[model samples]
Target: MSPDQIVVTVIGLAAIAFIVWFFWLGKRLGVKVAVNSSGYQEAMVLVKGGYTPDLIIVEKGKPVRLNFLRTESAACSEMVMFPDFNKSAHLPEGETVAVELMPNQPGEYEFQCQMGMLRGKLIVED
Candidate 1:
């Protein structure tokens, strides 16, 4: 291969590696819900490029309140959906929106953006 071709191939390979690491092998931030004075398990999730604490843990059979603060104006981040709980919320830019969930059984659930680009997980424990 020519010198130019080699450089291009290397760059392409690097880009592919970055994408894989970012989307799959990156470090995931997890937050365990805390029971607030209002008696609800709550956690604040920052929304920008993605959910800050993408992994949320809470106890089953309790109310879980996830406060999502959208810091970016990206259209893809406007909405968050919890398919398992059939709950969703519109997150306005520069404002906070609360999405509540009640997990009667201990299991793992998924939450994502409207486009499913940004994703998160909710783990309900016994």
Candidate 2:
């Protein structure tokens, strides 16, 4: 092959490698958190409106796991929802369902029940 052609091929390969490496690094550094409502131990986070500790602290640019737990004795605990993330899922009674949230920005994101009675916040810190 010609010298110029070989150099071009090398550059192209380097670019592809760089792109893959960048994505891998981003994933590795991403944050992950898990919140379990109805959790036997961590169950029921009580939040009293504006600015509460219901705001869970998490690392910026990471994947968050929000676990919704429900009990058969409660009516509609399974219909919990989060408007901020545009997510709505009904979990079966006496079960745990996990939602994955990947927030790329550093900000406070609010999540609440469809009824708006239950609320929580995800506080991302850089």
Candidate 3:
């Protein structure tokens, strides 16, 4: 192969590797919900390119309140959905929307944008 062709091939391979690592093999960000004075678990998540701290930890059988602050106006991120909980909320840009759910069982529940482009997980533990 020509030298220029080899360089281009290597760059293309590198870009593909980066995409794989970023979207699949990368380390995920997580946070543990804090119990507020009212006794409900709460977490504040920033919504931009995706949900910041995309993983949340909470106890089973407790109420969880997630405050999502939408910082971007992306159409794909305009709504957040928790299918397992049958809960969803509209996230307006520059506003904080609260989504509440009660996790009755210990398991992992998925939350995602309306288009499923942005995703997160809620882990409930005994």
Candidate 4:
């Protein structure tokens, strides 16, 4: 095998490992999750574009999981926001990546896409 072939193989395996680990850790954490996407006209209104379940409620200690469901061919859904935790993740297109946020205090944590068009709120209650 050539060096290029070996590198490609390694990269492929690494991607698989990352995916496996992502799902495994996600499930193990027992994160409370909600799915969102810009599927139709009504649904798009909630996210203002391509986000769904824009309004979420959870306990202070509980982790909030946003399974960013991207249905478009382009890579429009790039990142998410959790201002309370100061956390953000760059979401890849056509993938369901998860983001976990643990809000210690009871308040509303807001999130939006990079473009600021898509928005959501996490109401953390005590």
Candidate 5:
């Protein structure tokens, strides 16, 4: 009945809407990167409900660097692991952590959070 209550309700609805829309739209939108002059392909992935550009396509036999930025303070998003690469990094809130990987073969490599709730795939192509 109060203006304050109305504002709070509206904000809550907006947050829910954002979450739904993000998951729905993010699934189809993936970023591709090619090896730059620096000898690596660069891509920025956001860690929220999951990794943005949830799928990344990179050239095989080249290096790719994923710059992961953790915007959420959730504990689950604090750590990212790439089992196939034998690599893992602790992602601090509001900081961008770079994970460089070189794949000599063509295949799909998976990355995820500590809890395995967040998943991402990297497709290596010739």
Candidate 6:
């Protein structure tokens, strides 16, 4: 291939890779967890690339307590926001932060970092 063809091929590959990663990352990192006896569904969410185990599954009409531990110092993961609940929290480096909420409806609730790069979801189901 010529120099221009090589460049075009490289760019095309990069775009395809990004598209696949962007769509699959969420499902790849998702984890379904049940609340423990202590009434909390806990997970350690790594914040470097995004929230690990981003998808959290739970029963509907029940109060949910989520603990997020941010292990990275990236500014993009400094804070977590739950727009559905009107909740936002600052996550200090290397600490576990708790978010308590009562989700009475069966739906998908989204959470993300301040810059919206790190993303998470709570799937409330029957």
Number of the top TM-score candidate: 3
Which pairs of residues collide in candidate 5?
Answer: none
Question: Global lDDT of each model?
Answer: 0.93, 0.58, 0.93, 0.61, 0.90, 0.80
Tens-digit lDDT string for candidate 3 (1-126):
999999999999999999999989998867988789988999999999988889999999889999999999889999999999998999999999999899999999999999999999999999
lDDT of 2: 0.58
> How many residue pairs clash (N, CA or C atoms closer than 3 angstroms) in each of the candidate models, in the order given?
0, 1, 0, 0, 0, 0
lDDT winner between 2 and 6, please give it: 6
Ranking by lDDT: 3, 1, 5, 6, 4, 2
Where does model 3 exceed 4 Å of error? none
What does the lDDT read for residue 27 in candidate 1? 80
lDDT of 4 by residue, 1-126 (tens): 999999999999999999988745533212233333532111121222546666666666655555566655444456776666778777765666667666678886778876666767667777
In model 4, how large is the Cα lDDT of residue 42?
Answer: 18
| Sequence-dependent TM-score of model 4 | 0.57
- Comparing 4 with 6 on TM-score, the higher-scoring candidate is 6
After superposition, the stretches of candidate 2 with alpha carbons farther than 4 Å from their true spots are 1-53
Q: Where does the lowest 10-residue lDDT sum fall in candidate 1?
A: 27-36
For all predicted structures, in order, the TM-scores are 0.85, 0.53, 0.93, 0.57, 0.77, 0.79
lDDT of 3 at 42: 94
What lDDT score goes with residue 92 in model 4? 65
lDDT of 1 by residue, 12-37 (tens): 99999999999889887678888889
Q: Residue-wise lDDT of candidate 5 within 1-126, one digit each (tens)?
A: 899999999999999999998866545655789777898899999998889978999998888899999999999999999999999999999999999998898998999999999999998888
Model 2 lDDT per residue over 30-95, tens place: 223444463321223322331133456676665666556654544434465666678777766666
- In Å, residue 55's CA in model 5 sits off its true spot by 0.3
Q: Rank order by TM-score, top first?
A: 3, 1, 6, 5, 4, 2
